[model samples]
Target: MPQPEDDPGSAPRAAGATNAGATPPDPATVEKLRSTIGSLSTATLKQLDADLPWYRGLRPDERSALGMVAQKGIASFVNWYQKPVSPEWVLSDVFGTAPTELTRSISLQKALQLIRVVVQVVEDHVPFLAPAADQAPLREAVLRYSREVAFAAADVYARAAETRGSWDTRLEALVVDAILRGESSDALRSRIAAVGWKSQARITVMVGSAPSEPNVGFLNELRRVTGRLAEDVLVGIQGERLILVLGGVRDPAKAYPRISELFGDGAVVFGPEAESLVAASSSAQAAFAGLTAARAWPGAPRPVSSEDLWPERVMSGDDTARRSLVRTIYRPLLAASNGLEQTLSAYLTLGHSLEATSRSLFVHANTVRYRLRRVCDVTGWDPLIPREAYVLQTALVVGRLSAPPAPPVAANGAPGTGNGRAARAGSIDKAPPVPLGRPSAL
Candidate 1:
């Protein structure tokens, strides 16, 4: 069997030659070798000088001479020797301590030059060591190094993925909050940057509400459908509102209706096109403004866009303004005396029928004529004039619609009473009890 130093299984060392057949090394010689190597300077040249004694003491040439003897089996030992000089040089030249610290310091300029060449070799060797079937010791070393590198790479990928995901989630949340709050365009822009959104991509805004949990569930279903179409849409909640961010749309008209169909009759607003993320952020705010306008106005279909409703943008901020306009244009009839107001309201309601008005109010036909004439006298309103009547009727209808609903009551004052009409009409003074009695209504 080969001695330990000559065994292929042994770690490579610079002193393999003396161990072939000579007496095993004494402890003194081993200690001296170690001390000599440890004493070398960090300077590579000084290390090379220290290596000479370590190499010559090994008697490597004598070992090579002994290798020809077939019976001695020295050839095996000779063949197993590796790095007869280089391995020791690595331990000494690259890592040894120096007695004189000044001599150990390499010129910064020279160190940099050497480092460049060394880096190039490492880069070039990476591919060679990655493959299988290299020498067992070399392969094991390479694989262990690779495992360390792979672990580092995995850690980096995990960190990046987590960071990006967290950032996007926060971004979506901010957008939704802005939409629900009906924030201003400038505020929306500020929020976008605050959430670390990409400042360069085009952005689109959507505003609507999901009244119940089911509606939110519907929104998620709808989001999945849009995702299948490959549209990048982000969903988040703000207050009671649901806001969505859409991008990469070349044409909006095509996209708008599809969303409308998904949410029939629900309020939705889309903002105008924006060139960049900042612009899109502002545009989303504009769209929310459009939603407020739609809710305030008389007529707006779902998925309303800011562009189509520019003329009436003023109404979004001032709903009372619209109501005031309707009121001002028709106040004359509204403020008329109660009798005249009743007559006018009835005439308009019964479709200009004096008979119907009389029957409806439980009055004589002639009484309605008398009341109509009084209405004309008091307010100068004439049912005969179509234009004036039209205006008066519209005002009355709008006023009633705007007003609180009246309480329901029976026509009769109470049950089992023939005096209901008399009670309602109040008692006539009947000529103040004159000496000669007068008939009622006389």
Candidate 2:
């Protein structure tokens, strides 16, 4: 039932039918466009400067590169008008005229603005460049070419973003790994600069288990999220562990609760702040050490401070924790009022009995209570709390081991005989290691 006059055209005719009404510009007009490219470029640049507020703000060389782009686009349109083939060369013919670095200096939106300026300049000169009969096709050609340019600009920018994103991710990993290795090398410094790290002070480290289902997109989201909470951040996902180095967050009291839950099911640990990213190894080491020992304290708070795990870290052989125990507990108690240290020692060694401790020091029970409160204030650990007392006793042993006083001379001039070694606290008098157990009293 085919109608004899309803035959479709041949391949060439069908393909040519796509542009049936809008014709390619005549050779004379194409040659004219070629001749006027320079004028068109000048007009485009002037239009860009006048119409776009940000165009004048570009550096001289950057502006010159954009001029190259405008000139090349006009030339490309002239070439395109001859055959008016597919717009495949839009990327190379137009954007490729400028140096590769130009794309980085200019944004896609700004690129479109300049492309619009180029198209507008060509349209304004259409009457001068073409005869009365040729003006409509010339306008149509310019319109089609400008549409291709806009699409090409978007595609080029999208690729540039992906390339830059990948390079930044690798650079960030290298910097974080270098910090983990305690490297402050010149190359490391250069890498940090390349990563655009902003904070030069108060760097901190947080470590936890990586998610079971690892996702590059999740890491990206993490970087995006923390970038707001911190002045700078570095993220690394190595094997099963995820490490983060945050900069410029001097106090994370409010930020930690939200941040800690971002990690997987495990203890999250953050170390104290270091002065700079180069000095962040101290923080990283402490955080990693706490992550290793955090399992000891099953009920330890999520996202626990490395310093908060001093007792567990000490048990796990962290020398830094040992030194901290001596500094935080022993040294502070040594400089406190006379009775605080003795009261803590008596209270623990006397089975944590207030009455027994009052008698051991020959002080009233009310006096012992007062001293215990002072102990809590001095060391920030309460002797009345069972767990904190454990930490205090461990600190006592570490402190005693760190610096054991010399034996005293007796009245009869005998050395090492005045004070017996019987679990005394804060006395140059002899004392054994503080016991971890209590006498089953309050």
Candidate 3:
């Protein structure tokens, strides 16, 4: 429908109608609102103490800090309403003064509750401060500003949480590094405590190749997998290698199969379990040495024990492996009194043939077999298996080299020329033979 042209005086009225809801508050009204901010802040604090359990539970200093925040928030709101809509001013003025650790003291939900109380207090005073016709637009602005405050609160908490997570990860990596490096300082213990390490539980280290691609969730996945087995883990990914310190494991060998898939494709080795983390350095040393030497054995198990790779470690000049071999296998066999050492030496020297070894030792084949069984019972290594025989043979050579030289004696109970071959032959001949029957039970 065509309309007649209106008077030019009505043009200003038309523009005022278009901008009605968007008009800024009068100078007198803005000053009156600012005058009420201090009282409003006090009322908001009272409301928080009366209604919010978390706020009421805060200590005196924390309560004081929160009170300051409330006062600043009220003052900031007054300045915000005076200016045109600027959310950045609210952030810098209201929340910027808040201490960084405020999030640690108050949760995001509780902070939102605080914001609600502040907004409600402000809304309750709106009718008294503004004319009835102006109240609706002021209330709408308050609601909009509250939403911005809520979003800013969430953003602050999100960034704080991310920072805490990153700091915890770095501290955990340092703790694992100290453990693997064999550092048992009081500082290390304190750091372990800081990281909430389970100190009393049994701890073992697992070493393997790191994944080619970085996975930020790798540690979480490791924890998920190990947690299914009722275990806790601390992980460190150092360059091409990944290390995990597993806790609360009664049997690492049993636990390895379930968690081996977490590691990348390579030789994964589990160190022996220590009584606690302080003593875990020995285990870590063995596992790391084994991981380095595991490639030597192409058929090594995916999650092989550090002890299982002792021979390879020794070959690779691992002093711990050499000492372990000497202590665990050689020393124990030497200390057992049933001529087990001589029998083992003969068994290996005679190409692992029971008949040849028996002939060499002047004992019945059954007796030789019985001694071999005793060796197995003592050392947990069966001579029949090629791999175990190799370990035993290596142990024998290492043991002989480590022991003091034996004094020379003649065969006929007389001092003789430096040869002990006849003495060794006679000693074998003079020993009592076992009955030719089923091998004696260990």
What TM-score against the true fold does each predicted structure earn?
0.33, 0.84, 0.82
Model 1 gets an lDDT of 0.49
Give the top-scoring candidate (TM-score): 2
RMSD of each: 20.9, 12.1, 13.5
- Ranked by lDDT from best down, the candidates are 2, 3, 1
Candidate 3: stretches off by over 4 Å? 1-21, 26-28, 227-231, 250-254, 349-370, 410-442
**Per TM-score, what order, best first?**
2, 3, 1
C-alpha lDDT of all candidate models, in order: 0.49, 0.83, 0.80
Q: Point out the worst 10-residue segment of candidate 2 by lDDT.
A: 9-18
Deviation (Å) of 410 in candidate 2: 9.3
The best candidate by lDDT is 2
Off by over 4 Å in 1: 1-135, 179-205, 209-234, 245-249, 260-442
lDDT string for model 3 (350-407, tens) is 7889999988989899999898899999999998898888889888887788889866
Q: How many backbone clashes does candidate 2 have?
A: 0
Among all windows of ten consecutive residues in candidate 3, which has the lowest summed lDDT? Answer: 9-18
Colliding residue pairs in candidate 3: none
